[model samples]
Target: MAVVAIDKKDLLAFVGKALDDGELARLVTDLGMPVEKITESEVQVDITPNRPDMFSAEGLGRAISSLAGIKTGLRNYSATDSGVSVSVERSVKKVRPYIAAAIARNVKMDDALVKSLVALQEKLHDTLGRRRRKVAIGFTDFNKLKPPFTYKAVKPDESPFIPLGQSEPWTPARILKELKQGQDYGYILEGHGQYPLICDSEGNVIALPPIITAEMVKITPSTRDVFIDVTGTSQHAVHECLKIICCALADRGAQIQSVNINYGKKTLTTPDLSPLKTMLPIRTVNKILGMDFTTEQIKEYLERMGHGVEIKEKGKLSVVSPTYRNDIFQEIDLAEDVAIAFGYNNFEPILPQFSSIGKRSPSDVRAGLIRDLMIGFGFTEVLAPYITNRATNFEKPMLGEHPAIHIKNPLTENFTMFRSWCIPSLLEILAASKDQKMPQKIFEVGHAAILVDGKPVEQEKLAAAICDPKTSFNEMRSIVEGVAYELGLKLEFAGLDSHPTFIPGRAVEIIMDGKPIGVFGEIHPQVLNNFGIEQPVTAFELKLA
Candidate 1:
């Protein structure tokens, strides 16, 4: 979700009328964008990630107008051919293959307009752009560039140009080293043999895709005509980004124009503003909303939600989803849109005909016993998120080649993969508490999603860590032995070796019922250093029975 704050006057002007704070919030909430706060001068909204179109004031206003019946059905925008062609060279295909181009002509720019463009670009970059990995965007002064742009690759050391916000010309490699952007975004281009570059006819670089743009071609308050380019690993994502930006620019009185994408083997023009068509069953919509609406009434609601609908003979509707709305991927998505348009607050809730008592599952009961047992031993329980990155789950744990459930479209690198174990999470907590206190004993009886035959299997496990200057493997070993004793079970210990996560011979494997169950050991100095922890630590983990 993205939080957006817009000027009250600007929002009213875009909405084409004055709306009270409550009224605007209510209507926008119906659009799935809820109001976080509203004041005399500003309105802050929480926009869902699915509707990137609502990230800007122009997009939100357009949707509001259409849903309010001020304007209904699919609002179409046609892109005129700009005659600007961007040639795609084969050299950069191995790097960033797909490129889509659009020209926003007759753009009227002001301080607010400029800020809005930058905001939309950045918000899209964070979400649709996938942190500029799956997609990246670049915009420059259209009139300043000569026609016939070339997208190609070059040696990082050989290519030199003035990066955005800088006066000095630096090599691509040097920019990654010396500039702040390069330091932050250089990972996208660091290991590749050749880096991606976009150049105009006169050999002037417009901007480096996925990185900084050239200073000479950057957009400013005086810039009227704008050239937008989106390059990515996926062709579909590139086209979606172009569609979103073009729609926003069109709302600002700019003429949308198409640019030819010369992909060598095949050629295509970008900014495909055509709506995607899909079929929605009337019965399905009614079932989900729990309300029966006439086909004509349903069509009216769909139109108000900015979808073109055609009634079919059999309880089916042909829906044309607007190009700006990317969330409509299935019939269920249309059902959600219909519910929103029908007004959720107006729905009547049905009381349950049957009542029953609810109780925790068996796993929860076992977890409760383990948590209480650990707490009785003076260990504090802390909760951690299920998702984490590779550095903490793998590199820090020294468990290479371990696979976890990874997200396809991650918002940030911080929580990009699921955890298969709970011990690493415990260590991360200890590392962050270095300044607070010593002897920080903590434990977690949490769920871990382990991959089973390519599917995730969720299970509850217990892990505990005791950190202090005098921490040793013996301390953790005794804790495990005492727990087993309380459970009235016999356990055996065996030397654990060959694991890089702990010291060579200091680690031990716990065996119960002639089966290897768990392990505990003094934390390796190298592992502690990797986590920035100076104190010694000992930890143990096992599945909850």
Candidate 2:
């Protein structure tokens, strides 16, 4: 989601209506843009990243007006050919290949409109433009430029222009280092021997894009005609952005003109404002919405949402979305548009089929009994968090041969890994309570995820630790034996040589019914030192499975 801030005055003008804050919020929400916060002067709306057309005041205002009945049906915009041609050089194919340009004439300019244009360009660059990596936009004063432009790959020092926000001219290489916009977006062109450069017929630089535009031909409130160029590695993205800009300006009463894009021997005109037709499944819409809407009614709803709909009586709708819109693809998209136009608040709520039953299972009973048994053994039950770091989870290289599970993108390093064993947490509890008393005995019965066959397998275990100067391997073994006997399990212990977290000869594998359950041992000196615990620790863990 992207947040778009619109001046109330500008939005109201484009909407062709003056709305109170509450009404405006409700109206925009029904138009597929969720309102964030609306004041009397500004509206901050959460624009879905997919709806770049809805990311601007004019683009969304057009849709909103139609949905609110202030405006309706498809708006036919007119454009005249500017006869401007931008030649594509073969060297740019490996750099920034595609270039689609357009001219918007008779644009009614004002300070609010200028700011809106800037905001719309930034939103496109951040979202569908992919931070200018896949696409970048360039806007210039149309009257100041000559016809027949050239988009080519040039050496950084070969093309120099006064970049926007700067007074002096700068080379593309220097701009990447000295200019903040360049420094932030410089990585996109790293290691490239040549950079993308756009210029007019007389070789006056238009822009050094995916970076910054020229200051000489910048847009202002007085600029009536606007020239827009979209250059990138992807032809689709470049065309998509160009269409969005052209339509947004057209909504403001500007004429769109296509620019001839010369690619070696072939030529193509840009900013194709023609609507793309798609099939809308009426059956899927009815089934998903749980309401049978007639084709005419659905058409009305789609029209109100700014879409052109034609019903073929073939179980699907012949749908057409505006050129500025790129998010509509599947049946669900039409259903959503219909729902939005139908008003989400108007839908009747229905409760689910059945309520979930709340009851304790056998595992809960066993866990409760084990918890009580540990308390009965004079050990305090402690609870710990499930998320932990690597050092705390696997000091002994973990789960025999398998590594412990770790989070892919943790918000903080403190919660970077999953717990593979409970003994480490028990030791941490002792270290935190070291200042309290001479002897600290704690136990925990919790779930841990251990790696098995290269995948994390979650299992429940009962782990207890006695941290005291006199605690020994015998004490830990007796505690485990007593707990197993109380649980009605015949337990046997076999000597385990060379354990990582325990003394080599003092550890033994706890087995029951010929299956190894866990290990009990005197905590190794190195392990105790790693956790900063001075007391000798003896611990035992048992698999509840």
Candidate 3:
């Protein structure tokens, strides 16, 4: 989510209605955006990434007007041919491939409008642009540049221009090495042989794509015409970015003009302000929202959300959303809008009917008994996460790798696989709690996962550890025997030798009905060194079910 601040006066002026702070906050909150705070100067609201069209004050005003009934239905804009063309060279086809551009004439640039434009560009760059890797936007004074612009890729040494806020010209390589922005975003072009560049007819560099714009031509309060260029790897995102900027400018009394993009084989015009059409079935709306809405009511609700709706049949509607709205993809999106328009609090809550009464399972009952038993023995129960790394579970614990379920697309290295045992997690907790007082005892009762025939299998297990200077294998064995006595099960112990995680000849395997269930022993000194713990530890594990 992105938080944006809009001037109080500018918001009211664009909305074309008078609203106090309380009313304004309520309206935006009802539309699913919470107002963070409202001061005397501005109102701050958190905007979701899906609604990038509402990132600016003008965009918010447009939406507020429709929802408040001051102005309803989809607002349309017409683009006239500017005759200014941009030529796409084959060199750039592999670098930063797609580009969309437009021109805005007679733009009324005030301090408020200028601030709004800057904020919109930065917000878009941070969100949809993926920090400028997926998309980048550039703005310049249109009167300074000539027509028939060229967008191409060139060697780093060949592209030299004065970057913004600098007086001397710098090569592309120098910019990447010296400038702050280049250092921050230069990784996007790390392995490319050439860099993307945009220049005017006279070879005056307009901008270095995904980097910095030229210092010669800049937009200011006196500039009446503006040039907008959006370049990125995605065709859909580039076009959508252009449409959003054009619509935002148009809302500020600017005349939008389309530019011709020449791709050597075909020509295309940018800033297409046409609406996207889709069908919404009445039954889907009713089923999703859990209420029946009349055709007229649905039409009104869609219109309130700035959509054009037509009753095409008995139980269907032909709904068209504005081009700036890139969030709509299916019928459920329209139903969400209907819910918003009808007010989420107005819906009634109903109890769902079930086939039978619910009760605790046998495993749950046994788990409760074990929890009580552990607490009665003065052991603190701890719950560890199911997701853990191999280093903490295997390498540090002196246990070699085993078949554990791993994540295919892990976001980070810290959490890449499921834990195969509970002992490692308990040890990790003790390692972090070394600063506390001595004689710490902890236990965990949870599921451990393992692979069988290439499929994951979970088993219920209980593990306990006592970290104290006097802790020994005999103390742990006594506790294990007490647990078996409470559960009314006769158990036998067999001496274990040469265990990798425990001391040799000091660990014993617990048996029930002539089948080995688990082991209990004193942790090896080398294992304590691996976990950075200075105290000795005695631990035991048992398979509960």
- Per-candidate Cα lDDT values, in order, are 0.85, 0.85, 0.89
Which 10 residues in a row give candidate 2 its minimum summed lDDT? Answer: 393-402
- Candidate 3 per-residue lDDT, tens place, 438-527, comes to 799999889888899999989899999999999998899889999999999789999986667898888989899999888889998999
Give the TM-score of each candidate.
0.90, 0.66, 0.71
Give the residue spans of candidate 2 off by over 4 A. Answer: 165-168, 314-316, 351-545
How do the residues 141-197 of candidate 2 rate in per-residue lDDT, one tens digit apiece? 999898788888888787788999888889999999889989999888888999989
Write candidate 1's Cα lDDT for 151-253 as tens digits.
9999888779999898989888888888988888889887898888999999988878888889988888788899999998878878988899999889889
User: How many Å off is the CA of 94 in candidate 1?
Assistant: 5.1
Error of 1 at 186 (Å): 3.2
**Native-referenced Cα lDDT, model 3:** 0.89
- Least well predicted 10-residue stretch by lDDT in candidate 1: 401-410
> Would you list the clashing residue pairs of candidate 2?
none
Candidate 2: C-alpha RMSD after superposition = 9.3
**Clash number for every model?**
0, 0, 0
